[model samples]
Target: MHFLQQVINGIAQGCIYGLIAIGFVLIYKATETVSFVQGELMMLGAFLGLVLITVLGIPYWLAVPATLLAMMAFGFLVERVAISPILGEPAFSIVMLTLGIGYVARGAVMMIPELGTELQVLPVPYRDQSVAIGGLIIGMERLVVPAVTAALCLMLYLMFRFTRIGVAMQAASQSQSAAYYMGIPVRRLNGLVWGMAAGVAAIAGLLLAPIVMIDSNMGFIGLKAFPAAVVGGMASLPGAVVGGVTIGVIESLAGYLLPEGFKDVAAYVVVLIMLMVRPNGLFGGEVRKKV
Candidate 1:
């Protein structure tokens, strides 16, 4: 039962990582660049939620959607103003730019008028609430995280798989020039993809805030999630989900079963093993180029 409990806890945390990993995969597919600022985006979203609820005296339910929409717009503008201009630049330059953007985001959050580098509770209604199943106590947060993550995954799958815009986005990701020639607004789609990714990251932040304090450094959680994206296959959405849960479970068991600090490095260990075994990831497709 104790072991089962740990597994459940790990699953919940893994869902959070999965959501963030999905954000990473989204941008990668849309723009072929790994945005290193996802963590900061999540942090900013959480902070924005905090501001809306506490500072602006907005209702929690209303504030939630509002925050998501606002972050989406923020992401759109970011892509248009900063990322879009360097679409064909060297990969190293793009990555370094993303890292700089992350730093700017973090610093911007810390410089906010009323909320700066301080730990604050989000005051969510679900905070400190939990339920028991089969004699095991589970927090509402643990339950909410997985449920929401599943819902988002399904919605995204449907969108990308069925919607016209979704097919267009996929086309643009495949080749910008071809997409543009086909009359698909590749630049516009890229901005929308960035917006959507930011919105997803905001959802992650909101869902996670109740489980942990909303803090400037909370975005560091993204660092942990990066392994999830890699292990799952950066190009596969479902792989990201599976990889996150796998990493989360391993970390949970390691925390209890392994000696000393094994929990901290467990995700990386899994990544290394996965890389050695399946370089294309569990669900990732093979890539080929004719020389």
Candidate 2:
């Protein structure tokens, strides 16, 4: 029973990692850039929800959509004003820029008068609820994360598989020049992709806030998500979720069964092993660069 409980806990935590990793994969797919700021974006989302619910006293349902929309707009603005201008720059520069953005965001959050220093709990009605099944107990908050993630994944799959805009985005991801030449509005699509990624990050933050206290440093959880993206394959969306759950389960089991700190190091150790054996990731495609 204890083992089952741990597994359930792991799965719920994994769902959070997977959700953030999906943002990583989405941006990478659209622009081939790894946005290290995803974690910060998530932190911002949670803060947004906090402000809406706590400060404004907005209802939970209304706050949810408002937070998501605000995040979507913020993402679009960041891409258009900050990221898009440097699209042709070296990849490392773009990476550094995003890192800087994250630091600035964290600093700004810290500058907030009342909210920065203290940890606050989100007022999610489902926070303390749980369900029991044959010696196994699951928190409703935990169950909600995975359910929402699965539904989001399904919606994303359908968007990519059947929608015209999705097809255009796919084409742009494959080859931007070709996509532009084919009249796909590649630049606009890039902004949209960033927006979409941010929106996903917001969802992750909202879901996570109820589980963990909302705070400026909450973005650090993105560290775990980085390994999830790598383990699953940075280029594969489904792989992100798979890798997240795997890492989550491993970490959970290690935390329960092994000595202290093993869970924290497990993600990096797995990444190191995976890189040694398969550099392209579990689901990554092999690419041959012509010299």
Candidate 3:
């Protein structure tokens, strides 16, 4: 029963990591660029939700959608102003610029008069709610996270499977020149992709805020989730979620079963093992050598 409890807790936490990794996968698929600011985006989203709910007194339901839209627009703006000009530049340069942007965002958040370096609670309705079933108990937010993530994944899958815009994004990611020549607005779609990814990150933030609360350093969780992205395969969306859950389960089991401090580094250890064993990742498409 205790082990089952850990698994449930891990799944809930893993859902958060998986959601962030999905953002990573989305952007990478669209632009072939890795944005390290994803964690900060999640943090920023949580802050936005907190302000909406607590500061502005908005209802939690409305605040969530509002935060998601705002974050999406912010992401679109970021791609246009900061990343668009250097579209063809080296990946390293773009990565550095994103890192700078993330730091600037964090600093800006800290500068807000009502929000400083202090940890703040997001006044979510489910803050203290819990559910028990068959001798296992967990918070409502924990259960909600997985359900929301699963829904979002299904929605995205459907979008890609049936939507024209989705097909165009796929085409663009595969070969930008070909997509452009096919009359697809590659630039515009890429911006939208970033926006969508940011929107996804915002959902993650909203779901996670009640569980972990909001803090300046919370964005650093992105580092742990990064391994989830890599372990699942940077280019595969489903892989990201699977990798995240795997890491989460491992961490939970380690924390309970292993010596002190193993929990903190367990995710990275799994990532290392995955890299050594299956660099392509589970569910990732096979790499082909060019003639």
Candidate 4:
């Protein structure tokens, strides 16, 4: 029972990691460039939610969509201003640019008066609430986290499966040159993808702020989530969630069963093992070699 309880806790934590991992997968799919600042984006989203709900006195319900939209626009700006100009540059340059963007975001957040650099709690209705299912107990945030993540994933799957825009995004991801030649607005879609990634990061932030207090350093969780992306195969969307849960479960089990410090390193250890064993990940598509 205790072990089961820990698994539940880990799943909740993994859900958060997976949500951020989705941002990694989305941006990579759209532009073939890895954004190292996803964690900072998530952190910024949380701060936006906190400000909207607490500082401005907006209701949580309204703040949710407002914050999401705002983040989406901010994401679009990031792509246009920072990422778009260097579309053909080497991947390393883009990666470093993103890292710099993240640092700027963190610094900008710290510049906010009274809110920056201060620890703050989000006003969630379900905070401290719990339910008892048989002999096991569960916190509301823990239950909600996985549930929300699952729903979001389902929505994304459907979007990519049935929507015309989804098909265009897929085409662009597969081959931007071909997609553009086919009359698709590949560059515009790239901006939209960045926006989409940012919006998703914001949603993750909103879901997570209730579970953990908002802080500038909380973005460090993105470092842990990056492993989830690698473990799941950077190109596979569904794999991100799977990798996150796997990492979460491993971390939880390690913390309980292994030495005190093993928990922090457990996720990376799994990543190393997975990379050594199956670089493609559990659900990752095979990379076809060109002649």
Candidate 5:
């Protein structure tokens, strides 16, 4: 029973990691650059939600959609103003730029006087509430996080698999020049992908805030997502989900069965093992050389 309970906890945590990993995979697929700022974006989203629900007196239900939309627009603007102009530069340049963006985001949050310097609890109705079934107890947050993550994943799968914009995004990811030649409007799709990634990150923030305190530093959770992405396959969306669950489960088991502090490094240990065993990732396809 204790083991089962731990598994539940881990699954929820893994779902959060998976949500952030999706942001990483989305940006990488669209532009071949990883957005290290994803964690900070998650942080910013949580703060925005806090402001909406706590400061502005908005309802939690309404605050969620508003925050998501705002983050989407923020993402598009980030790409246009900061990311787009440097498209032709070296990949490392973009990477550094993203790191700078992350610092700027964190700094911006901290500059908000009262809000930035403090830890906050999102006033979700389900906060601290739990239910039990079959002699096992479960937190509402544990149940909700995985359910929402699964729903989001399904929605994304459907959109990418069925929608015209999804198809265009796919083509653009495959080869931008070729996609542009085919009239796919690759630049527009890139902006949309960035917005989509940001929106997803915001949802992740909202779901996670109730489970943990919403703080400026919560974005550091993205570090775990980085391992999840690598373990699952940086370029494979399904792989992100798999990797997240695996990491989450391992961390949970470690915290329960091993000494204290094992949970912190368990994800990275699995990542190293996965890299050694399957360098291309569980779902990553064949690598190619342009030369």
Candidate 6:
């Protein structure tokens, strides 16, 4: 029973990591650039929800849509104002820029009065509720996380598989020059991809806030999600989900069965082993570069 409980907990946390990993994969596919600020973007999303619910006294249902829209707009502005100018720069520069953005975001959150210093609780009705099945008990909030993650993954899959924009994004990812020649509006697509990624991050944040305290440093969990992305294959969306669950389960088992702090290091150790054995990730395809 205890083991089952730990597995459930791990799955819940893994779902958040999976969602964040989706953002990482999306941006990488669109621009071949990793947005180191994705975790901070998640933090910002949670803060947005906090402001809406706590400060404005908005209902949770209403706050969700409002937060998502705000995140979309924020993502659009970020791409246009910060990322677009450096589009042609070296990859390392873009990475550093994202890191700077993350730091600035975290710093700005800390500058907020009262909210920055103290941990804030998001009062969701189902936060502490749970369900029991036989000898296993599952928290509703924890169950919701993985369910939502799966639904989001399905929605994303459908968007990319059947939608025109999805096809355009796919084309652009494969070859930007060809996509542009085909009238795909690659640049605009890139911006949209960023917006989409940010929106996803927002969803991740909102879901996570109920499970953990909302704070400036909450985004650091993205570090774990990064490993999830790598283990699943950075280029594969489904792989992200798989990687997240695997990492989550591993971490959960480790935390319960092993010494303290084992769970924290489990994901990274798995990632390191995976990288040494399969550099492209479990589901990632091999890319050959012509010299």
**Which of 1 and 5 is the better model by TM-score?**
5
- The residue pairs that clash in candidate 4, if any, are none
Worst 10 residues of 2 by lDDT: 282-291
Where in model 3 is the C-alpha error above 4 Å? 288-291
lDDT of 4: 0.91
* C-alpha RMSD of each candidate structure in angstroms: 1.4, 1.3, 1.2, 1.1, 1.2, 1.3
Per-residue C-alpha lDDT of model 5 across residues 1-291, encoded as one tens digit per residue:
999999999999999899999999999999999889888889989999999999999999999999999999999999989998998799999999998999899988989998898888989988778898999979898899999999999999999999999988988887788897898878878888899989989999999998899888899999999999998889999999889989999999999999999989999999999999999888888886374
Please write out the lDDT profile of model 2 over residues 22-54, one tens digit for every residue: 989999989999899889999999999999999
Clashes of 5: 0
In model 1, the runs with Cα more than 4 Å from the true position are 288-291
Please identify which of the two predictions, 1 or 3, would achieve the higher TM-score against the true structure.
3
For model 4, residues 177-271, the per-residue Cα lDDT tens digits are 78989999988998998998898889889888888889887888899899999999998889999999999888998998898999999999999
Ranking by lDDT: 2, 5, 4, 6, 1, 3
Which has the higher lDDT value, candidate number 2 or candidate number 3? 2
Q: Which stretches of candidate 6 lie over 4 Å from their true place?
A: 288-291
What's the lDDT for residue 269 in model 4?
98
Q: Candidate 2: how large is its RMSD?
A: 1.3
Full-model lDDT for every candidate: 0.89, 0.92, 0.89, 0.91, 0.91, 0.91
- Which pairs of residues collide in candidate 3? none
Displacement of residue 224 (Cα, Å) in model 1 is 1.6
Residue 150, candidate 6: Cα error in Å is 0.9
Q: Against the hidden reference, what TM-scores do the models get?
A: 0.96, 0.97, 0.97, 0.97, 0.97, 0.97
